[model samples]
Target: MRLWAASVAICMAQAAHACETALLLTIDVSNSIDVAEYRLQVDGLADALLDAEITDVIVQGQSALAVVQWSGVDRQELSIPWTQLRSRTDVQTFAAQARAMPRAFVLSDTAPAEALDFALRQFADAPACDRRVIDVSGDGTPNSGSDPRPMVRAAERAGVTVNGIAIESMGLAITNFYRREIITRDGFVITARQHRDYPRAIREKLLRELSRILG
Candidate 1:
């Protein structure tokens, strides 16, 4: 009877923790991003995850989150591992860890292709969720490594969505580049006029994505 009771408890726990969405957030740490800009990006993401609405959705939806820092080829690091947000404390703890994460790469080129490829491979280790989304935020087009178009196609083929946040300083050049080559057909892009606008842009992006998960 005890063994049967343990089996039932394990099944109940698994049902309670089923993952709804696996979200992988990628940050650019190439040479273009100055120290201040990097801080703004990381802190902004931390704050966005802590927003009441975003936090509620993440916890309620049983979302699993991870963060990857990427720059030049072979310079992507999973700064935060996949964490299941089962409660407000879980979300808050993850946000705090995000804010405290150190830079993974510096003085490197912008290699979106490598970054996207790296982000895609990470999903293999993430929790099994109904939706797999990669949120990649960058300021410039790829200047090093292979083309990113292939990785975008790969994401689409794998049924994973690759959204982009373009930090544009010169008009819509970066935004247009992302639209043309980065995100998948089911993915979208949000444009931040400059590094200072990162906080607002990331908050809006998170809300949009999490709300869609709720729907």
Candidate 2:
């Protein structure tokens, strides 16, 4: 009887920790991203998390989040560890942490395939959630490492969705590349007119991801 009671408690604990979504945000910080552009990406993401609608969804759904900075084949860092947004305070704390984080890599080449591979490993450590998503934000296509399409397929096989946010500083070329090679079939892409517009794009993307609204 004691063993059965302990088993029930363990299951209850697991249920309580489950979240609506586990989102892994992978940002590019390759050589092309200047210091100012890097700041924009980091600060923009911080501000997006503070958006009213986004905050509300996060708090209500208790979504898990992590941020990764990726560049060349071996340059990928988990800037923000797995955190659960279960309340207003939790959201605020995450925003503050994001804003204060230092750039993980610079002077590195673009490697989207390696980035995706790294992000997939991150999911293994995340809290259990109903949906798992990888949000890749970058301004350029891969110029180094393996092809990203296979990684996208691997994500699909893992039942993980891969979304893209293309920073269109160099025009729609990068956006087109993302649509063709990065995002999964069930996922979509958001285009930021430039680095400065990342905050708005990220907010909208978060809304759609958390709410499951394709539009």
- Give the whole-model CA lDDT for all candidates, comma-separated: 0.92, 0.92
Compute the lDDT of residue 60 as modeled in candidate 2: 77
- What ranges in model 1 sit over 4 Å off? 1-15, 213-215
lDDT of 2 by residue, 89-135 (tens): 99999999999999988789999999999999999899989999999
> For residues 113-175, what per-residue lDDT tens digits would candidate 1 score against the true structure?
999999999998999987999999999988899999999999999999988899999899999
Per-candidate TM equals: 0.93, 0.92
Measured by TM-score, the strongest candidate is 1
Candidate 1 whole-model C-alpha lDDT, 0 to 1: 0.92
Clash count per candidate: 0, 0
